[model samples]
Target: MSATKQHPFYKSLTVAVLLVWTAAVLYPLVWTLFGSLKDNQQFMLGKPWALPKFPLLWSNFSYVWETYGFSGYFLNSAIVAGASTLLSVLLAATTAYILARFAFKGSGTLLNLYLSAMMIPMILGLIPLFFLLNEMHLINKLVGLIIVYTASALPFGIFVLVGFFKTLPRELEEASAIDGAGYNRTFFTVMLPLAKSGLVSVGIMNALNIWNEYIMGTVFINDPSKYTLPVGIAIMQSEMQYRTEWGPLFAGLLLSMIPVIAVYVLFQRQIADGVTAGAVK
Candidate 1:
């Protein structure tokens, strides 16, 4: 078999596989969109695979947002996810920078400790953490949840950013020092900006994880008003047994997905580059 002939075959196979994969990924989203536009009668009596009927019910979204209180859930999620991501990235960047650049006693051990912490499942610590937060009078508070998320996200962020910091040229720091920049100045004005891609990757990943987190929200939040989107969605599901509102439920789901999809689409290039930055160097 000639190289050119084999190349075409592999290329064709790759394209075929990608096409199939794309369909698999897109079908559920399309189905969800169709489901969201439908009424309860359509789902109960009509074909499962049928397209949405005429006069799409866009009010489903408004109903879920206002009547069902997804607006509150969305706001809570945004605040928690945004705050946690910012704190995690800031702390991780500093910690990673120090660990990567400076060699001192116990620094390696500290880094290793952080790396090992990531290996421990969050479930293992949930019980103790709940009690600890309760004792601190932080349980059922957004502040508590934010603190928990920030702490939990730290290990992964540090692990990723350590590699990124290491990849950056030492000469940059040296050059900054020569220009009369102090440690904080150099880090903020020079090194941090250079690691923007890594920061973006870490921020987005942590945001997504926190936004979708249901277990913690359900466990810590007692007030319905304090519920995150995932917790809100779960509540909505439970209520479905008594009175199913499939349209609003699907609409709620679609609403949850939009921010995540938007983020990935906008910063996907940065994410790819950041993930690979550490590996290549």
Candidate 2:
């Protein structure tokens, strides 16, 4: 078959697949929205996929937010995720820039170490990490969680930003030098601004990862007040088993998803650009 003739068939196939995928992704969100507004009777008697009955229980959100400590959990998650994402992206940008541009001895080795770290399962270090945090008296603290999240996210950030830094023109640096800009000034004012897409992309990815992180939060934090959203949700699930507060449970889940969804929606263009940047260069 001619390439032109095959294009339509392939395009149609792609459209069909995308439609199916869209439905698959959207259904759960719709279901969750419906379920959050429902009462216990609706959950027990109504069909699983049924729309919520009249007089929607908007109080489900309030119930979870106030009755359980989801508000605190939300704040804790925000703090950890926001702080860690900022630290990780800043540190990664600087480290990646040095490695990509400076051409120092052992730079390749250091980058290789970061790549290797990415391959290692985070679970393997949990025990040691737990003990180390305990020794530092950082266990059960949000600051400790923030630090851990920042470190854990660094490898992926470095891996991504390194490519971005390498693809930039060296003439930018030379020009900055000609204008009497030093290394720090050149990086901060010239190159860093130029790599905004990559930074935003990495920031969003790291924020999402840290926000959704459960195991580390659950392990490192024992205080109920210190619980992140995921851990709080897990606790809410267990506590609701006897109460049958499915509405509040669903509401909690919806709350947890808001930040993640908002971030992707806002920065999706930057993410797309970041992915294609190296190829374009």
Candidate 3:
């Protein structure tokens, strides 16, 4: 039996599967949104799928802000993620340019080394990293967190950028050179602009990763004031476990997600272009 006509049942089954998948994905976000508006009692007593009546959205948000010290955590997270992403992208761009454009002795070996580093699990490095950071007296500091985030992101960022840069036309560089543009000028004025989409994509990914990271932040930053969103939320959860205050927790979760979602939405076009270009090239 030749496909479509004979597989009418299969088509119906596929449609049903897709509907279920869509509901599965969307239900949690809808539930969380509703839950954020409910008090601790209502959240537990009401149906999981029910919408809130007289939604206490503002109260819940206010509670989260005060109870979790969310303002401080938000600022700390923004600083660390932003600094790390900026540093990583700049360093990645330079390193990627060298790897992609230059043909030096043992270039392949060096590239392979970078690739190999990616395979090593970050957890394995934590103990030694912590000890080293302690020696530098960087423990419990935002700078140390930024440094760790930058280092952790560098390998994958460089790998992605290297591929993107390699796909760029060499003719552009040669044309710039003929016009008396130096390497720095050509890279900054020509290549970087052309590669803006890729840089944005990499930077956004690094920002999200750093912002959500809990393990390293928890271990390295003992001060509550220095805690990022993830760690602060975790602390809130632990403290409120007996009472189980769902309202503030849900509100906090929603707040934590806003920046990441906003970034993806704002740069949606650039992210799409970057992925498409990277794939095509």
Candidate 4:
């Protein structure tokens, strides 16, 4: 509230800093977007920082989709990421609910186990998980990727939901019990709805994680036909054909980015509210 605190210089400096950060973050996306509108030769030879030539070539995206088999990759990623998010959120919510609802033996131990799992590097489990999936005949399949993503994401999801659930009042449970509702009914009808923000938060995070995952796809999948978007894009980058197709490659990058941006935009409010609510309660 002081004169110095409300100085125009301070306001100007803060605006300048934020503008710089925004440009730093958005420059790549803008570069990629404009580059995607040019022909490969023009894109590669021309100035990268400049605008694309007019009569914009939209064929790059189509080429990436049809000529490079990106459509299948997109579909595969959606299936894997979507299924993993659903399973991870549901299982994590149930587990967190149990831990938060009542005092039980070894509850602290169980919670610590989950938290400890988060600290373990996923790299350490890669070989064992590969062999385990191979034994179960889940290798080279999206289902196997789904299972892995779901399991790996569970610890984080449970940690977030536990915070939300612990903050809920005991009166909600007491009221449910008074209505003669069983545990399952009360949880699904009352407690679950109350945790909507937390669930959405975990769900969005897990979806983004699985969608963007490359290592899991690389370790498990062998068939090019079965490749998820990340794996497919990696393979494309490695291939000689895409070496000259810079425009299409940028087009592919933009395509891969769209779903992620959409998800964030759609659930952004929920994510903000959930994190804030957890902190406040």
- Candidate lDDT (C-alpha), each: 0.92, 0.91, 0.87, 0.90
Which pairs, if any, clash in model 4?
none
- Which predicted model would earn the best lDDT? 1
Q: lDDT tens string, model 4, 1-281?
A: 99997999999999999999999988999999998998766755657667898889899899899988999999999899999999999999999999877789999999989989999989889999999999999999989988999999999888889999998998999999999999999999999999999999889988998899999899999989899999999888788453567788889999999999898889999888876776565
Which digits, one per residue and each the tens of the lDDT, describe model 1 over residues 1-281? 77876797888998999999999999999999999999999988867679989999999999999987999999999999999999999999999999999999999999999999999989888899999999999988999999999999999899889998987899998999999999999999999998888999899889989988988888888888899999999988887788789989999999999999899889899888877775565
What is the descending lDDT order? 1, 2, 4, 3
Put down candidate 3 lDDT per residue, 1-281, tens digits, no spaces.
67775687988898999999989987887788788888766756756567787745669898889867999999999999989999999998888889889999988888888878889988899999999999999999999989998998888777778878898899999999999999999999999888787898888888888988999999899999999999999999998868988878889998998898788779888777775676566
Better of 2 and 4 by lDDT: 2
Best model per TM-score: 1
Clashes of 1: 0
TM for candidate 4 is: 0.95
Q: What pairs collide in candidate 3?
A: none
Rank by TM-score, highest first. Answer: 1, 2, 4, 3
lDDT of 4: 0.90
RMSD of candidate 3 to the true fold? 2.7
For 161-221, candidate 2 gives per-residue lDDT tens digits of 8888888899999999999999999999999998888898889889999999999999999
